[model samples]
Target: KEILLLLVADMKAEYIPPREDVIMQNESPDELYIIVSGEVEMLESEMENEQTVWTFKSGDMIGEVGAFCCRPQSYTYRTKTLSQLLKIRTSNLIEAMKTRQEDNIIMIKNFLQHHKKLKGLRLGDLLHGVGGDYGDPNMYVNLLTVASTGNAT
Candidate 1:
């Protein structure tokens, strides 16, 4: 099963040029972009203030929660330099996963892991309570489990 997923069909990739003053702080729009190459900076916005949260590189997935939930974006990401990305529409990803069950399962696992890592960081930030920091790690884990089991709602 793992081998089958490793051999699954690959998606097309796209390239983006560097831009100045890119807003890395905005609500998520539920889109997933797999970083094929280049760099991106993640930022969070609160009360007219923006802070750099993280930097993503190749093989990293962005906007997983939004892609899963079909909700507003929770963070903002901007290219730190010229970048190449595989833009996977959430609807298309969901459909493809349905067709390729094994591969879909692997993808779901990867998404869940990424979600957990992000959720942990966000939860820690919330504990500090210096910003509009609010997140539920358990809820995210539950969502992933439900979605992967084909019981998402």
Candidate 2:
């Protein structure tokens, strides 16, 4: 899937005020969020106590692990400041996945593995499908080019 265009075409942009939870820990996962502005805090609940695990800022994509895996959200994501996010419904992604062949599954799996080290805006930048200073534009171009040409080298 062309996640950038898919998000632009299929997601909804929402503005969230500060100190509000975008999603709560253990909530039923429904959508993936891409941070467009401001910061978000990721928290985990343990024995009724919440602990901050990580912080996501503009350009970060969150809630995908649970949504893509069809599981409950593992952490709470709250706005640390005023924020804007693009929300992609899990149902949309599932529908898209259903239309793809087996190779797309592997491609998505590899894509997930490749994205593990990326964070926040940098990751978001890559997902936008636009070449930027933070990520190599050629990577996406090359990947698509190869796929289109039926070459896997």
Candidate 1 lDDT, tens digit per residue, 1-153? 533343234455778787433323345443578888888777676988878777878987776656665545556678888988877666666766676676776777776676567643652232222224445445655666876677766
Candidate 2 local lDDT, 1-153, one digit each (tens): 464455458889999999899887767778989899999998766787887767888877788755654445657889999999999898877666566556455646554654665645333332332334425544654554454355786
Minimum summed lDDT over a 10-residue window in model 1 is located at 123-132
Candidate 2 residue pairs that clash: none
TM-score top scorer: 1
Candidate 2: lDDT over CA atoms? 0.68
- List ranges where model 1 is wrong by over 4 Å: 1-12, 20-30, 115-137, 146-153
TM-score of each: 0.68, 0.66
